[model samples]
Target chain A: MIKLSELHLGILAALGGIVLLFASANFAPLPGQAYGAGTMPRLIGWCAILLGCFMVATSLKHLPEMAKPHLADWVRKPRLAFAALACLAVIVFYILFAETLGFLPTSFLGLLALMLVLRTKWPTAILASLATTLAVYYAFSRLLMVPLPRTEFLSFLG
Target chain B: MLIFEQAAALVFDPYVLGVILASAIFGMLVGAIPGLTATMATALLVPMTFFMDPVPAIAAIVTATAMAIFAGDIPAALLRMPGTPSSAAYVDDAYKMTQSGRGDEALGAALVFSAIGGLFGSIVLMTLAPALAEVALRFSSEEYFWLVLLGLSCAVFVTPSSPTRGLISLLFGLFVATIGMENPSGEPRFSFGNLELMAGIQFIPAMIGLFAISEILRTVTATIPRQKIPRSDGHGIFKTQWKNLKKYPVQTVRGNITGTALGILPGAGADIAAWISYAISKRFSKTPEKFGTGHVEGLVEAGASNNSAVSGAWIPALVFGIPGDSITAIVIGVLYIKGINPGPTIFINDPQTVYAIFMVFILANLIMLPLGWLAIRGARPMLSIPPSTLMPMILIFCIVGAFAIANSTAGIVMMLIFGIIGFFMEENDIPIAPAILGMVLGPMLEQNFITSMIKADGDIFRFFERPIAGGLGVFTILIWTLPLVMLLLRRRKQARLAT
Candidate 1:
């Protein structure tokens, strides 16, 4: 957990602003006008640059205190850190596998894994995951008409 | 009269009414939970809104947000934990009231006054929005540019943290809005050749990632355990509310007025409303010393203020397409999705739908009384649900919702990326509201600026030639310069003091 202080965040923002300006430079101006696609992005870049500079200046007196990064209590604990990662991992898992595995199986797996990681009992995890996956699939796909991805492997269930 | 009848028919239909009822219950459930904000509740409801008629969908959000805002008081009173950020203003007073066995009074005051405040705001919305829209019908690109800039200025200045950080967040959002080909030039600037990126970031998934996912991350990293709710005193929820109302009539009216005014201001919302109203209540109270010691006086005023502000926020959103707060920002997105563009033109185009919406606000507030009563009785059980168990379910909902946005994996990827950005932004004390507002208004700002530039042939002074545009421009500039001027004046004052 590399906690960012005001100074670090400011520097990062300033650098990001510069990068945006350069990238936006490639966008040619619109025809018959002075402004173009680059206009807003460029405006934002300058604003960011000014904001970053202001942040740095205001915090200069407390620069030492503002620059040090401190870990949150959960970040210091491996279990909690993993819990946070598992939350992200589930999303990543769905992104990678949902289209291939289908919405039901992929979602069920993600839910079950997360419940267990969050320390739910196996039975609770299994039952809750099963119920929720079916309910969500129905409510979204059937009721709301949102098309959840169909599984190539598990075609019958969906 | 005929239009009112048409709107009444629209609102009273089985489908829209059912949606409202279901969303109200959903709102109560979400609001009674600590760490789940009203804005998150709105975000979560968006996917469902994607399927329905525009009236029902807007009805759903309207009902849910009003219920959620009021329901937040349940946890605040019972557990000393604010269910939503807006409820936080008077949490100490609410908790103390419960401890002193005046729990019924505290909850009652919160529910009743919230209803009163919400109704007042709705009436104001009903009356003021159309008139404002009529005035806005005359606004050209120059006027819109100034208005958008003013809105952004409000967002930066009204945050709970450093203005510089808020400005950074606002800039980040502005940058994000410039991602696709909808700018002045049709050429995509930052799409990186990704097809989905060319369409630009969908506000729904990005919003879910920011409010929902970042909150989940924060909860996981939280060191504090859930607080135990106090046992019920077995008193009727609304029994003492009448007495309190009689005693605090001035406070109630003042709070309602203050909240509605603030709500009408772009970028300021219910949370700020509650805080300001609570402070005002204390200042005006005869027994100001009793405020934090199990007091119901402050709770009454602030609770009313929050709910009213929720209604107040819709005024600008409906009239000008500028969001009054985070919730209304999401509402504007929904409005656009429904093909009911918000502006003065909306009044001319969809008068019936506008009336239906106004009716929904009144209905949502009216029902808050009964629904809020039930929630109070059920608060203990709801709050007892462990965060560890609850969080996983919410995360699943977030993932599905992200995927459901465009029915593509690309939306999920955007969610993940924005989730990280949101988490990082929160960690750095950059206010998220500005970013959300920036995203909502970014294109509007750019579109107007470009059109005005073309209209004026690159003459900057033309932007200020029109009376309304000049006034708005001056106001925005003044707001932007206020801090810097204050800083300079402070330095000079300090030098004088040292001498």
Candidate 2:
């Protein structure tokens, strides 16, 4: 069963091993530092391992019922999953093309793609995305002076 | 204190006052929106801070963050949807009250309790930050190592959800912290030879990707092509609800204390504070059964706790360079960029600035009441707008916000990556807060721990040498241990009953 006790014991055991590994690490014979870098991490690593192991042991002894999960229960929703993926794709496109296309074009295109995937009206999506992109661009470039990538194609708009 | 005088000067400044008012309105608007967050507002505004004086910039950012934190409750109260993760715990409770025609009362309670919580946390920050920073200053690598361990240890017990999940999340975070570059050796320990891994994780973007982007992904799937908005029955949302609030002062106070304490811990933000406060309030409530079924006490506690957390989060920032949460992490970055280094030296070097910032805290909270009211009043009309019209705008903002963080295309890529992670995690019912916490604290934990062991020559006892470290370590153990002990006792009782 997936009770807190079992989880605790598992954590403790894992942490214990980590601690030992760090404790055994050589901090001395390294370059010109008063203390070796591995020293603090190793110490904390040990503490974490000990504490984690203790938790696993404690959980196994009690609250065993908490570990029992209903594996049969599963999400059947498809639209939600698809939408989530679409959002991801748009973001990736924005990141990959933001440099070549510039902030406004890239953001506008990302928003347009997301809007299409979400099934928004074309006019509303296009206008809103463009306006929003322009506003943020102005706010950042003119007001904040955070250097934004500008393309040679868009330079004609100036 | 001589520091208090400069605080007075800063508080009296009209520009500072105006920005606080602007921030409150901004916070309410963002918080009221379903997809937006205070962190986004803060990140977007960080660039603007480069143009202003330090005092005004800090005033604007802090005020907005505090107000926005409170603003999240508005949508949660009005719609069944939560505006932010911090408000998620109370959405059902508050929305249930709204459905039963107690929307005004619920709104009023949230407004008042948020102010109280913010005030309480601010007081704690003002009274304790300088002193704490002085102690934190004494911490060389050895002390910091212990302190970080104490914090991680506390997470084992302090998470508002299942203790096991909390500890698992903490461990996961600790593990991630081990990735990337090594300080002592200047050699990459966890990078596995990747150049990108050498810089470690680009923490802020990773956090944004995990928490913000992931959230978007999860919601995208479940978002009905046409989501239904349940209309309110012509109720007066702005009407004050003093009668209900007066009935639960104790709940509000407890919420404030818990929220403030949680907020003071780095990476533990308002969401955890709200959940923890709500849980504690429920435990002590005489009518515990009414909790998820529209309990006013739950709302008061949740609202107060989250708002208070905003102020409590400032404590770590002011005292040490360490940020209490992600937003504060960005704030620390801003402070450092402005040449105003935090830590013990800050108070000694510029007591007046410290006091001034504290005064901003008080002023921001007070200003929040009116600002919150106006935003709630104004945004109600906007809330009715269909998601189809709004979703595109939000998507644009997300892209811009992502690009704006580091002005790099790679940051946008990072956002998408984390967004996918966040979405999957959410669908699986895994909390994203821990991921953000991990991203923020991972490097700090690694650096401090490594430094400490090097100092003590691998003697773990060096962590316990200081009274503070010892106390913190013990406290961390107590948190994880107590839960296990209680669970054991309950199981024994159950077994006896069964037999």
TM-score of chain B of 2: 0.73
Q: Stretches of candidate 2 above 4 Å error?
A: A1-82, A139-148, A151-158, B1-16, B19-58, B68-110, B122-167, B182-186, B192-194, B223-248, B254-359, B378-389, B451-468
Q: How would you encode candidate 1's per-residue C-alpha lDDT over B201-282 as one tens digit per residue?
A: 8876786677668877876766666445455576677878788889989989988987887687665588767866786677
Weakest ten-residue segment in model 2 chain B by summed lDDT: B151-160
Residue by residue across B384-489, what tens digits does model 2's lDDT show?
6555456556555556555565677666676676666565555544455554445445666666665666676778887778787777666656655776798899
Q: Taking the candidates one at a time, how many backbone clashes does each contain?
A: 1, 33
Best by lDDT: 1
Model 2 residue B323 CA deviation in Å: 7.7
> Rounded to one decimal, what is candidate 2's iRMSD?
5.6
- The candidate that achieves the highest DockQ relative to the unseen native structure: 1
